[model samples]
Structures are given as C-alpha cells and as structure tokens.
Target: MFSAPQHAVAVACLTSVIAVAPVPMRSAFAQSQFTDVSSNWAQPFIDTLAQKNIISGFPDGSFRPDQPVTRAQFAAIVRQAFKSPATRLSRPFKDVSYAYWASPAIDYAYTTGFLSGYTNGSFQPDQEIPKVQALVAIASGLKIQPVGSVDSTLLRFYDAAQIPNYAKPGVAAATQRNIPVNYPNAATLNPNQQATRADIAAYIYQALVSQGRLAPIGSNFPASQYIVQGGSLPATPSEAGTGTLAVGTELPVQLEGAEPGANLVMTVGENVETTFVVAEDVVNTRQQVVIPEGSKIVGRFQPFEVNKTLGTQFTASKLMIGNTPYTVNASSVPIAARKKSSLSIADLTGSITTLAASAALDSAISGNVRFGSLVPGIIQTGQTIGKQVIGKSDTSDEVILVEPDLMGLKLNADFEFLPGSTTAFVDPNSANLYQVDSGTKVDLAAQTDNARYVMVPGETVPVELKTGRSIYNRQNEVLVPEGSLIRGQIVPMTVNGKEGAQFVANEIVIGTQTYPITAASAGISPSSLQSLSPADFQGNVIASPEASQSLRGVSSTGEQQSGGLLGLGSLIGGSGSGKKVILFNPTSVQMEFRAPLSLNNFNN
Candidate 1:
C-alpha cells in the first residue's frame, strides 16, 4: 500500500501565502488589553491582533475558550473590529428578543444580508457554533468567492451527506473562497461539529487575509507561472467534457458511436421498479389459511425482506415477468391463529415487472388499498347476490386510467467532411421526441471540433479529444435536446435586447457516453456550488454513475368477501347440487399502471 504523506509537512514545504499588498504591523498598548481573556488557542488570535489592539484579555485574565460565545458577545467583537457602514438595522428573525445581548450584532448581520433566521424565529445565542456555521459567518464578515466549481468528490469520509441544509450553501461559499484552510476534501464539509477556539482563530485570520484586510504570513514559495491576470482566464483545450449524468436523462452525442472501446458506456437504467411482493393474511374472518407461495416476486422489492421470517407464507403462488419465469422462496410464520393457512397471490413479494404482469390477478383476488372499493358480490342464502346495475351512476364513480407512456426517437445525418474539419450548426427540426426551439446563437460556440476528428459522418476512423475546457467554448456553447434530463442554475443573458436563459450543463449522458459539467458552467452562482470534488466521482468506468432501482407501471383490480354463504337448499334439490363447487369466486379485475419519472428531464 502507498503510504500517506503528512499534511502539515506537505503544506509547509509546498505552499506559501500570497498577498496583493504589503501591510504594516502594529502592537496593542496596556490600556487596550483585556486582563482576563486567556485561552490556549485564543492566544494566537489575540497575539496576531494584539499588535493592532484589535483584541485583548479580559479583566479576569481568562479568555474562557471552552465557554460558548453568546450572540451578543460575538456581535460586539465583530462590530468593534469590522464596523458596518449601514445606518439602520433589519430585524429579520422573530426570536431575537430585543433584550438579547447580541441584538445589535444580529440586527447588523441581518441588514447586511450576511445571516438569516430559521423557519421558527429563534437565535439560540449561547449554543456553540458548528464548524460550517462558523465558516459561513467568517466568510460573510469578509467577502469571498471561489475561482471555479470546487468538487468535493474525493471526500471519502463517512456521513459526508449529513451537512445540515441551513449551512450547506454557506459552507460551500466559504470553501469556494478558500477562507477555511482546514478543508482537506470537497465532500467532507464536517458542518455542525463543534468549533474549537484555535480553529476559530485560524478561520478568522484566513477570512481576514481572503478579504484583503491582512498581509501574507511568513514563508515564501515560488510564484506559479500558470497564474493568469484579470479578465476571464484563457481557455485550455480538454479532450472530453466534464460533468454529471443523471438517471433518466439524455446527454450529448459523440461523433463516434458507442462501441467496445468507446470513452463511455451506459450500465443500465435504474430507479425503475423491478421487484414486488404480495402482502399476506386477510383470508378468513377469525382464523385464515395463509398461502406460503405468492404471485410473481419482483426485483424492485428485493431489499425489503431478504431471508427473514415472512410470517405466514403463500401457496400455489406464481411469480411471472411478462413471459419470463421469476424465482421465489417461501417460509412460514409460527402464528397459530388459523391452524393451517395457505398463502395467496397477495402474499408474494416481487419485482415491479412481475407485479405489472400479475396486476389483474392481484386486483381480482387481493384487496389492495388502490382497489379496495370494488368489493366482490357475496353468495347470500340460496339465491341471487349483489344486483348488477346497468345505467351509469350520477356521481363520477367510473374511473379512467392512462398507461405508462414513453417517447424515444433517434436521428442520423451525413455530412461530407475531411480530417481537420471543424463545424458549428444548429440542430435541424426533426420528428424525434427531443427537439430544439429557436434561441440566440451569440455566445454559442463549438463544443467539439477537428482536434480529434479522425472520421467523417459515414467514414470510420479512430478519434480522440484532449480533456479540458476549450478556447472556442463559451458559457453558452453547451446544447441540451428538449426532453433531456437537465439540472443546475439558469444564467440570464441579454443578447440584442432579447433576454434569454442559458442552462449550464451539470450532468449530461448521450446514449452510452457521459459527461459531468460543473454547476458553475451551468450558470449557478459560484456561491451556490455545492461540494463536487473529483473524489465524489461515483460512476463506474463503463458509465457516469449508478443507481439502485428502477420504476414500472401496471394496472390491476381484485375481489374479496366478508365470508357468509347459505345455499344448501338448492344444492340437494334439482340435478343442481350447488354445494359451493367453486369455493373462491372470481371477480372482475382491472389492471392499473405506474411509471418512474425523473426530475432531470424537463420535457419528460
């Protein structure tokens, strides 16, 4: 195994702080110092500001680092150091009682749009600050913006997704601005974990430096030659685009069709309902027979119950997917309510595919929540049972169901060209499910070109593109076919007096090839760029990503009885011995359907 290098030593040897301007150092005087403000970690912060008289020890000669800092105390310190020029306060939160100690600071932070309150109006002032919350506050105190979309993909820590919602945006913003020096990976925000005094000092100091209020610390590293001056950085050529591919989403089409050596390959459609199981019991009034073997088990519900005791198994149950055979295992529950019960179709658990096929049978026999209203006709005393109505009822009891609908189409076009051929053209209107409407072509440039064009439309040749951003690429160069899965922020651009919306591509997968563009490229505010580090790369080498299940739709109806039959008279009478030959009567079963819908595709 490769040994890991020490981070502290690596930072010390490889990186050095840089500054835009030289800052003069100053020291605090006797009267300006606090006598009691003392803490192991607070000293570094106090010492750094002591020269400028920004902070001092308290009269008690103690900093009380472990003690939680009240909102009022923090506000006072912030006001004293970075006084806002705002003339009035905006009381945004309902719970910041006027008597609260940090009322002024809270009010100031609100008016400056640096802080917001929760749904319930209360700012528990004494609560210890969380790592992410503190980072946000520090970044807000000193403005910061990240240079590019910061991907937290590499963050391998467990519970990475546990970052609270309230602090995610702020934490991301701070990370982008590089105000928090502790972040070793993009995925691990470690928000809501307690903050230490030493950590607080480091955060504040880094925030100050990022805001252009402080000078570079000691130590010097060679200036990077790759640094580019102001204005948009010159684009570097990348062979392939980078981005995420969402499930049920369509992406860009590569000039080369998907093949064995293709750059990308699709694993399988997921989140699709593939498995299902029939619910058990409910056969008799008091003690009912449980059927051990149930109807068609589905793959979708496979995760529900593995080899555990399924309480009362079903019998004579069949698992089917269209015409394919489905494998199902059965077990019994020791409950003695119904001495010996037989399992029914409803007792089986299975995949969505199997459930769709057996929907009619299930609805007729199994009283599902969706089909409970249509009770089966009962066989009362020796004659006719429930009357069959002919005319339609006054109320709209007749329900109509629409089956799962899908739209898919492909297009092939041929254009004569040579090996260095570069071209840019709008997609022609076609009959395919995905089509493009009219839009501005101003900032729209070429995404892929002659760099790796080894084949023409109809000719076969090997092709390879370098991976990175390209010079010809624009913020609007990306194109998404209508009905394709798309997400991220929409950047507004005005071209020729017409305001148009530009969707920065976040995740795109055309056919089998996948590409994940940064949210920033999708036009989302850099401040909103959530952790998306390369370490977060979740897709296999064959595809962009993978999901656990899939969805399907089917229709069904079934019948049930309360159990009360008395037709013994007509049985011994004429040649018709109606001694209940068919113990279980059949009922009209109507099938229903359902489908899995993804939010990525706007048209779908």
Candidate 2:
C-alpha cells in the first residue's frame, strides 16, 4: 500500500521540518492526574486525551503539557492514535535499529506517509518535532488535500513567512482540514515552534474530527477560532465561535403540567415513560436560543437505590430539541420515597401506577381502608409482610402514597452541535430571515362571531381566531402572520384550594397547515373569574353544558359545537353540585409561544 513517488517527496519534507531544542518523554504510564493543569487553558483538551489513552502523565504524576515532544515519542504517539494501513515502501534508516523502542513506530509512520528520514539515510528520532512537521504528518497521513491554493490558505496566519518552503502544502492542507490549533491568537500559526504535548493532543483531536471519527468540537473552543473553514475565517463573529453546549451542561427542565417542587408519586421498580419540557432558553453568546424551552426530554422513570434504600430516578434516552432528535446519556437525582403497605388509586399522580403495594398488610388494613396509609411504586400483590412494629394502632405513617420531586436532569455525556444547525437562524441574508424568541407571547382577539363554546377538563375546544394579527420583532420584521385558529384544552387545576381551568393551546392552524404550539392563559375560577356580558364577548368564548361533555376524551380534532350556543362558556366546578357554577371568559389571554419559533418554514 506504499506510494514510492509520494514517499520520495515526504522524505524531502520531514528532513527540513526540524527545530533545535528537544525534550525526553521517557516515563512509566499513569492515568491523568496532572499536577499543573489546574489553570492550563488546554486542560479540557488534555484531560480528554489522557482519559482516552491518547496521551498520559509522567511517572511522577505530572503531565507537563507545555513540555516539548521528540520525534521518536511522536512516532509512538502516531502509532497509538491512528490505525491506517501502510501505503508507502519503508526504507532502512542508519539512526534507527530493530532493537530501538520506537523503531517499529518509526517504520509504521514512514510507510504511512507520516514521517521521513534524512537524505543521509539517518532518521533523527531524538529531534524535537516542530509544529509544522507535526501538522504535516497528520494531514499527509490522512491524505487531506487542500481545497484551493495552498499559499492563500497559509496567509490566514500572520507569520506566513515562518512556514518552510517544502512543508507549506502539507501545512496548508492541515489548516484546511482544521488540524492546526493556534492558541492565544489564531492569526499566528507559530509554524517553527516546538510541538508541546498539549499541542499534539489538540491536533490529533481535530484530525479525528476531520476524519469523522469524533464529533465536532464546540465552535467556542479557543483553538477552534483558528480553524480555517473553506480556506478563510468564519464570515461572522458569531460563526467564529458560537456558544458551547459543553458536557455536564445542567438543563433546567420543567415537568409538563407540574409545578416547581411538586411531589410526583411512583412505585419502586415500576418503569414508566414521561416527558419534561425545557424551562428556559439555553442561549449562545449571541443570545440566540440553542435549546429552547418546551424541548422535550423523554425517558423512563424507573427504580434506583442509594445507601441501600430503594428510590426512583429518571434516565433520559431521547432528547427532542426542536426538530432534531438525539440519543442522550442523562439522568436525574434519585429520590427515596417512604415505604408503605397499600395505596389508593385516586392518590396516584400518573396513570401507570394502579396496583396495590404490599397486599400482605390487608389484615392491618380494614375493609375500605382510608388513605391514611400510602406507598410508592409498583408493589407486588399477594406477598406476605413481616414488619417488627411496636404496638401502634394508627397506620397513618405506615402504608401510604409517596411523592418524589423532579426538578431537572443533567447531561452525563458531552454534546456537540452539528454545523449549520443554527446557521439559518443567525444568517440575516438567509431564506429564514426572522425569529420569534422564547417567551414571545401574542395577544390574539377571539374570532368568535357571537357564539361561545363551553370547555371542561379532559376536553379540547377549537377557539376560532378573529382577524388575527401579524407578530413583529423590534426590527419591524413580521414573524408570524394573521389567519390561525387555536385548538386548546381547559386544563383542570386547583388554585389556592379553589377549582380553576387554564386554557392550554396545543396547536395552531393557518389555512390548511397545522403547527404544534405551547401557549396558555391565566387560570380562571369562580373567585378570580371575569364576567364578560353577551355584548362584551363579540364572538369570543362559546360554552354549552352539553358540548362540554361531548368534547371530553377528544384532543385536537372534534366539533367545538353540538348545536348553536352563541355565548360565553361556563366553568363547572365541584362534583355533583354544591358551591356554584359561573360563566366567564378569561381576560389577558395571550398566544405567546413557550419555545423559540423560526419563521423559516417552521416545523416541529
């Protein structure tokens, strides 16, 4: 697989690409616990490489990332890092012998088009490898050819004159391939500088990225600003280094339909699927939303154990960020719930939990036992219980429902954004020229023509839009245009111990197109309900006791009206009659979306 002609050119290049000073890397291997990386700028890069065994710390437990690396050690590193087959004939060198520690690696590197021996037939393995030589080795081994003129590509770095004549093409190819990582300032290539351990690690990582062996690093990485894209600097400052969605980014996620610090009940060992929406926007340095609110984190809420005590935790498997779906490694804190013997169905939070727990405690429970006792999770029924309890008549604290709180989850693995994911959102000249930021609410006048529809919990009513409106940004760009109807549900809730309903818009329809929407209204109740006279509600809210029952069990599609009932809808409260029922239309209702909306052919 060796190329004879290219091998001749490579031998000429490596001999001239040399520097004076050299450092020895001879040491025993140890996992990374570098003594001096606490404040190093390249700590993130070094840590990752060390963890993967691409590089290692010295025997004394010091990485000394800034120290220079010699040619022989670099050869060993190349062997450890890459696995390509030899494509060029290997020639015997006078300086390296079969007994040499790096002799095999030297042979592999030369045969793979990575390194070359001197014209005198001697390979100076102890010479410090220069940055240009290291970069050329990676580019050549990977067969990275410059897209355009090599001279123009090299000009991005201020010290273009410092690059040697023969190595220019390979160095330019490496820059084009994003293998050159200039620290402090990307404009200076520092071609003749000695290659440090940190420098080699970063170069190899970027090479892996170019080969698609690793995910693209975040644009905001310091070294990435120097990466020449298509042979030039990024067109815009934002493109130079966008926001970093780093590993361990704590995403503040809100459980759908659940309040903060709210208690969620589940059984131990019981697995259930649930979704949580992002509570806020994860913005970049440019204030553009990366992961907007309402992005769903769907996962399994299953059993966990901590300190030998049973608990529950959420292990996320799928992350739905806008239109993109990603498999993720993330989870929430485990919560240990109170153990119990039995539980009532009505006391549960989700629908999956229905069976009684610890059925052996039936004798301890009287017929039609009250909810004084509660238990969490799926409890195997028909099992015997042997509890050493001191004579206590009241079982209120024994068998009862347990509530676990789900605040937010954390990313367990590093996540990188793919290129062009946000390019359209930031490009003004692009087809998608407008963006409606998160928390952007629109005041939509009801489109009712003197007819009202009554809606209750568990039912969705189609609220017609009037003339509607055209939403605009501060720059006077129209984001969303008029002509849309809101299909919403009257979500039942308890506000300050009083029954109320919140209008949650689930979808919006414009002409024949339907788009999913997350919008809501300030809940309305008898105590806080605002009354709009028949004339006041031009054609807003429509209500009927009969239609409310018909709309039950239906979500997006169904008739909003069973017959003509042109008036305001009544909010029925309390079961089997009691307090009072009132007819009202909630004022200050807004159709603001809970997530980011891009007008460029917006989809889910």
Candidate 3:
C-alpha cells in the first residue's frame, strides 16, 4: 500500500541521501545509491529509514553515510521527519535571515523542541551538530524523560567524561528511548563526534520504534547491536510507569468481548485456557506503562478456594507483552461466582464442543442458540464450542461473568523485565532436533515391487529417503548430519479428466518424525504417456511417482533401479474406466513443509 516517492539527494543537511543495506527483501531504490555501503555496518538502519521516506540518497547513486551533518542540515531533515504541532512563538535567529534556504526549517525544528539556539542570541545553523546534540534533539521533541539518574546510565559509555553536562540528560533520555546506534563497539558513545548521515538515520529509526510506529529491529542486527542499554527509563506520567509492574499493582482487565451493554459469559470448571485483554494501559504514578492496552493475559479457571458457590478463579500464568511473555503470579476475583450451570463440561470443550457449544452458548447467552447449518465452517468463536474457550486476535473477545468494578486482577509478586529480557530469552527448542531449514534439497525413493500399483485421485502412497544429507549453518559449519529414513506419501490427482495426471505430495516424513508438507507436480498430459502400450509389459510393475514405476526400471531383485522417476510414469488415472490408457505421472513435483521440520536422533 505504500508508494515510494521519487526524491533527489543533495549533499550536506540538504542532501537527502543515506545508504544502509538491508537484511534482504528490503530495498526502495531501483538501483541502490547505497551500493558503497553494502559493507557499511549501518545499512540495515539506512535500508529501513530510506524505505520509510525518512531519508534519501544521491542522484548519482551514492549515499555518503559517513559525511558530517551540519546543524542546519539536521534541522532541515528534522523538520521533514517529525510531525508535531508548534508549541511556542517563533523568534528571529541573528545568524539566519528569513530568506535563507534553511531559515524556515531551523524555526520549525526549534519550535518543535528538536533544535535550540546558542545563548549569544544566535542560531548558528551552519555549525556541525555533535552526536549528543542530535540525540538530545530527538529525545526532547518526542517528550521522552528518563527515569532514575541520568549520570548512572551514561556511565555505561566508555567516554562518560567527554559528554557535555548540558547534553547528558538529553543523551540519557535518548538512550532509554533506544535511539543511540553505536557501531562496532557499543560501549563507545563517540558523543562529540560530528553527527553523520548513518548515525542520524539510525537515531530517527529507533525513535520511531519507541513510538511504536516501527517494530523494533531484532538484537542480532549490526545496527541494532550498538543500541545503548542500562539507561534509566522514564516513569512517564504521560505514557505509564517505568515499564514495570509492582507486586500489588492491579491491571484493569475485562473479558475481551464485553462491549457497551452486554457481558461475555462463560461456564467454568473446565480448565481450558481463557484469555483476558488489558482494557486500558496500567500506568504508575509517573504515567509510564506497566501493561499496555490490548496485551494478553492468558489464564486458567480454577476452583475458587474450593468454594461451594462454584465461583472459579482466573489464575494468570503468563503476560504476553508484545511478542514476549512473562510468568506472573496473579489472579482475578471469582468470575463464575454463582453458577452451577446445567451445561455439561462436554458442552464447553470442542468435539473437545462444536455443535453443542454453539447451541449451548446461545441458549446460555440469550436463552437460545442459532443453527445456520448442521454442517461445518459456520462454527464461530462465542458461537461454536471448541472456539469459545480461547481468546484469539481474529476471534471476538470472551469474558467470564463478573461485576465491572469487581473484576480486579491483582499481581501477587513484583514483575519487571530485566535488561536484555527480549534478546536473552531463548526458544527452548532452538537446538532441539537437528534442523534442516526450509528449502533444503532432499533425495528420496519409493520401494519397488512386482505389484503394479495404481492409485486413483485422493489415494496416498508411501515414499522414503534415498540418500543421506548434511545441513549447515550460515557459517558453513555442519549443524547436523543429514537425517535419514525420511518417509512420506504421494497423492494422485486426475488432471481435469483430460487423461492426464498430476501427482502432488501431501506430506513427507523424516526419521521417526512426521511433518506436514505440500507439493504439486507439473501436469502429465496423455501425450506424455503415449510411450506405454500395455502389450510391451503386461506383467511388469507400473505405478505413479509415489509408487516405484517403470520410469526407473526395477531389477529382478525388486530393488528400485536408478533412473529419473519423474519421466512419465506407468500408473495413475481412473475415471471408472477399467480400460487403462498408458499410465501417466506428472513430470515434476515441488514440495515444502507446511511448517518447519526439525528432528534429530536419526540413522543416516
């Protein structure tokens, strides 16, 4: 939906070009002007910003990323990058006249709190801006105020002493805002270095991320690696708290679907996963967010302290913030506080509650349930049994019956995200089972037999691995020896009753692991099968690619002989016709796992 606007790059602040290579699939320039920066550590930043229309590159196809940015140029860029309303009256700068090309830009930046003038009653617009100065400008404009002591956070930088006193707070705020992009070495702030195109691009990109306009780049990227941490974040009375929640902090939550007048009601006792959405952001005294609105709280319904009222407790086990989840000790007051429902537990869980759920839910909700069709697909969440128990992003919200003001979910213990919480969190299964990334090339075989195997449409046939393979990482180091004994099935499809066949794959197996795979082979028209006349080999075995066929002649020993199995097969095609036309198999098959298949402990 985004259209890239053509822009010309100029040199200096006015020059719009900055080149940052991408992490692939990321490019805006038809021919990259940042070609010189393919090896420049900041290309990811450049790629992101330039693509977002925040930066431009030279017309001659060069982005001098290392080029120093003058104060005036920075002001110009800032004026165009940040969207903010003016907060103060504009005043004349002694050094810049109204007619100066950068004059309006300087005033806009100054009014937006992104730039300031020297005390000598002059805006030295042409002076080269320093690293700290630029970061401060962005932090101030976005109204980010750091929490705790700025000095302590700044100490993480090796050049702590070199930071100008006035710029310290701004730099600290920027750090907490995650705006500093130090390359090669994270500890080196280089605060006094003249701001460069690359540096500014990274800062602006990071600022956007803090505002949630841009998703945070993963920590593995070079540009993301230098993002300074250890800075005290603000307990913004404007945003929430210190992005922390206290032991007793209560988050305002409601069953996700409770709209204006009606409440989502659920029958409890079945400990299926129930989800709650933060009704509003939970903020601290300073108004910094502890839990943001729309975050998920996955919980379970448990017996309420063994109460006879059948009031169940929703025990919060995990808090999903952004893409990460944290275990929490929290529980809500009784939801189904007064229900001994006539509905059976089977009435709630799906097949685990499908048909019955829809009827029972409607009956329970409005005293009657609707049945659009006795078949399937019309089964919907809140309407269908199996789906109503869990809260999904695409599904409508579900809430347990509870008083609006009384539904307080209280945290039993202090919850805080530690430094590098997101980055340090590892997938428990990252190294589990050796992984052959998607698109891994595999060689396989189907057992050859004397029996002529003929499969009609929708029929399945087994296939197996033929050779061993090794998988390697990007570093070319062997990740795992090729897993062996891979197995799966080949499915046959009639080519539109055209006397042709296309044998597509349904799944492939590796070792003892079964993975769902999808595949389709090129159509094999009858013309391709014209070579096979029944008289030539009445007793000879014939089958589709899934079954060992004549394309690879089988030896008398019954072992699959070597040859191209895809070269027009002798089996497949059934239209209630006992009369067999020379069997045809598709010429080729393309397959990939529906989900990534990673398994280990195999005999190669």
Candidate 4:
C-alpha cells in the first residue's frame, strides 16, 4: 500500500531540499507568493502545498493555476508526498529511461500503485492528464470506494453529461471520500476539462486530509463544503410535495389561426384570434410537476400603434387558458416592427429639396413659436410626400404577417402556484416571456430568390426551414428543437445610395402554433464561399446552373441583368446614370437565439 511520509519527517525533508536546491529551482518566495494564484479559487490549497514543498511555482514567481498538469509533474509531486517499499521484482516502463529527470518519481509512483503505463507498455510521461483521469488515479491510489450508487451520486453534478463511462466509478469513490474539490459552483463538476495545477493541489490536499495526513483549513471556499470530515453530503430537496409554479410562467403556445398566404393588413385595433399549446413541462426546484404539458392557451391581437419615427408595436390581449379559463393577466409584449425604406438618389435629393423649400416657406410665413413648430410639421409633411413619390417604386411593399406557433418554443416561469391551480398571479416583468433573443440563427430558404421575386415591406413571404437546431441552457437541457418554422420580413434600406434587403426574423412556428421571436443574420449562404466562383457575385442566386446558363444574362453591352431587382447594374455601376439600384437575389438565411430560454415551459 502507498503511504505518505510522516508529517515531521516530510517537513524536515522539504526544508532540507529547499535549503540545498539552487535559487533558480526554488519558488521566488518561501510562502505563497504565486502572482497568478492570488485570486484563484484553489489559492488556499496551492499555498498549503507550496509551503509543504510538495508543489512549487514557476521561476517567474507565478503559479499557472489553470495550466494543465503533465503526468511527469504529477508523478514527481506524488513521490514527494508519499513513499512506499520498493519491490524487488518491480519492472520499469519501457519508455521511461534512467536518464529521464522524472524516471525515479515515475518508478516510485508505479511501485506505490499510484500510476500505471498504457496497454502498449509506454508511460507517456509528458502527456497532460484529464481531470477525470487525475481523480481516478488519486482515488485508486487511496483505495477509496463509493458509499452509494455511482450513477446516482454523479447526477448531483450539473455537468454530469461530461463524465466518462470508465471514470464514473473512480469519480463516485472520490466524491464519497470527499476528495474531489470543485471550484466556483460546487454543483458543476467539469470532469472533461483538463486537470490544472490548482485542481491537482486541491485534489492532493483533500486526499491527504482524508487519509489523516493533514489538518483541514477553515476557508469558506466552495470546495471546502465537499470535504468529508468538514461537512456531510449536500442535502437534496425532497421530491415528495407538489411545487409552486411561479405566476409569470410563460407557456410557449403556437398560433392556430395564422396561416401562410393569408391576406393580412396592418390596422390599429385589429383583432386576430389564435390558439396555442404549452410546449414544455413546468417543473420547480423541487422537481415537482407544476404546469403539465399540452395545456392550451388562447389569445387575441390588440391595437398596435405604428409610429413613423419610432417603430411599430404589436400587442396581444385577452389571453386565457383553454376551456378551464384560468385567470391570467398575460399580454403579448410589444414587438418592435421597424420599417426601413429604400431611398434612391432621386428620392434623397427630392426629400432634401422638399424639406429645404418647406423651411424657407415656413420662415417667410411666420417667425413666432406657433409657426416655428409648424415648420417642422410642414417639413415632415413634405418628407412624407417625397417618400410617397420616390421611395415607393424603389422599395418593395412586402410585409410578413406574424402568427407565431408556440407549440415547441421554451419559456421561463416566474409565478408560484400549484399544478392544476386555476388562478396565477401575473408578474409585470413577464411581458417579455416569449422573446427569442438575437444571435440565434435558423436555416431558412426563401421560396423565390430576390432576383425572381420582389418582396415588399409588410408582405408575407414563404420561407422553409432547411436545418434543425436545438437551444440549451448551461445545464445542457434541450429547450428548442431544429427545423422549426421561422417567419421573417424583408426590411428595405438605402446605404451610400445603394439599395439592399435586410431580413428581420419575427416569429417561430412549431406544431401549427407561433411564438414571437427576434433573430437576424447576413443573408449569405454559409457555404457560399466554398461553392461559388469568386468572380460571380450572383452564383448563390439560384440552384446550381451550368456556367453557360449563368452567363446568358450578360449581354455584349456589358449590361448583366437577372430576373431580380437591381441585377448587375448595382455591382459594376448603375448604368452610369448615378441612380441608386437594388439587388433582389434570393440569399441564404440563418437565425440564432439571443436569450436564455427555459425549457420548463415546453413539454417533451
């Protein structure tokens, strides 16, 4: 059996080694002087081990706490802390040579049953050990055993999915022995992350403490709570009672009335009826079911004010839980529907002229406050007129009618109530319970390329989801599924006299229902660089066509035209007339979710 050196002798040997070792080989300070470990979670452990001379900082006076520990370094430390009787019949690893600096330590570690070579008979001493491997090695050396089911004990960790099958037993034993010290959130056991120097120090110190070789420190570090003698196993909340579901529990419901190709108009006070179903189950901290899956939610659209300067707002009102009609003070959060107008050179010049002329007329008409304010109103009216004449033809009038399917969308619960409870207190902060955040990319394909079809603002265009994706939280639970329907609208805008299309995602449709979502991405195909020719800007406009077929639109007059809006004129120069041009080529679209969505609102 491996044995640690007696405390007094170990301290003496460490002191003597420090005295005899060259200055460059010793730590810059006699105590904890590691610059890098000062604020580290494992600083205490590192300091204790450093003072004992079992571990040392770098020559630069810095302890790289997060740096991965190599097998050789670990072996050296193990040899310093522990000692075992050598067996006469012991054999050295084929790869470990006598001349190697770590040869002695490796031999000692192997003979002490603390380490072993690979099946191929090579020690690979320089290899960086994984956290799991390090823990397993320490557990095996100390002969620790699990007190309960290994799998059950591991489930206590938030990142249990990262634990490897082979390391389960060793990890369970380590946890039971209270030898594993996790930093930051003790609930998160990052088993797959590389074992760092700080991690090793903590593991070793805990191991020594468990073996009655060292006294425990009284630090409130998160890892301290897991020490066996210091504390008992963490208490898990009982799963017996029914937990309360917070009042602002959001149900991801799909819209049943809104369908593709439905003619819709933007008008204040418009009422659109929609039916929805809960997407996921709502469970509280006690793991008790609160809102069961498949609960139906009914809602209707209310007045949405459209402000030319600020943006448009859509609100849902009269929300009710199906037949049961649970009291809910739920209202659809006002979604920002901003419109971008495509401005051509003529439109910009005209608007400027109208405003200038209106200002001059207003100045001549009156110089007082009442008339002064009238100048702005007149300018605004002129600008509106200018847009009516110049912006209409240049920009598409298409708009996407939003009818969200919330069948599979995920939402967080904020109110507290029992399962099957009829009344739920609504929280005002829950207004944004269903907003799918930005940076979420969903694969979308437009029915027709901008080259073949003109998408006007406010016009609904058909888009098919091409790929499926899942959204997860830090706990790795699937909150949203792949291939869910996404609703988007073409936002037209002019930049530097150039017209462009910006697609803004509005909602996600799942299982015949819709939920409000906000996502955006550059409309370029993800694989466009690899699949298209560098010289051809419109290669991704259509399906793979022959080179000759793509070139058919290029005329001898250098006028290259596609079925879309601006064609090649925008690329090379708009017919040399100095007029702004727009390109209407169909482009690939991807959406990425921006917020952390809770899966408890949806059912599996």
Predicted structure with the largest TM-score when compared to the true one: 3
TM-score of 3: 0.42
Q: Write the per-residue lDDT of candidate 1 for residues 1-604, one digit (tens) a residue.
A: 0001111111111011111122453332213234443323234344465443333334355444444444434444454345343434565566667765566667766565455566677666556666677767755654433233322421322444776655555555564334453433333446666764444555555455434455433222111111111111112111111111111121111111112111110011111122222222111110111111122332121111112311111111123323333222211111111100122222222111122222322333332323333234210112211121121221211111101111110101111111122211212232332222211111121122211110101111111112232111133333343223322222232222233222332333333333332221111111100222212211211110010000000001111111111111212222222111111000111101011111122221
Who is ahead in TM-score, 1 or 2? Answer: 2
Q: What is the lDDT of every predicted structure here?
A: 0.28, 0.54, 0.52, 0.46
lDDT of 3 at 595: 19
- With candidate 1 superimposed using the best TM-score fit, by how many Å does residue 528's alpha carbon deviate from the native? 55
lDDT of 2 by residue, 352-371 (tens): 22123332233344434443
| Counted clashes in each candidate structure | 114, 31, 23, 57
Give model 3's clash tally.
Answer: 23
* Residue 349 displacement in candidate 1 (angstroms): 92
- Candidate 2 lowest-lDDT run of ten: 12-21
Please report the TM-score between candidate 2 and the true structure. 0.36
Tens-digit per-residue lDDT, 1-604, candidate 4: 0112111112332131111111112222334478787667677677777766677776577878888887887887777765444433456787888877777778877877777889988999878887888888887665555654688878778888899888898888777546777766667778878888888888888776544345555545434664433122322222211233432245555433322222122222223343444554555432344445555554443333332221222222223333333333233333323122221222212122223223333333322223433323222323311111111111222221232332122222123332344243232246433333323455554443332223322222323332345555455654465555555444343222233444445455555444444344443211211232324454333321222222333312444444231234333322232322222343334554432221224543
Clashes of 1: 114
Candidate 4 C-alpha error for residue 160, in Å:
2.5
Q: Clash number for model 2?
A: 31
Task: For each candidate, give its TM-score against the true structure.
Answer: 0.29, 0.36, 0.42, 0.34
lDDT of 1: 0.28
Model 1: worst 10 consecutive residues (lDDT sum): 546-555
lDDT of 2: 0.54
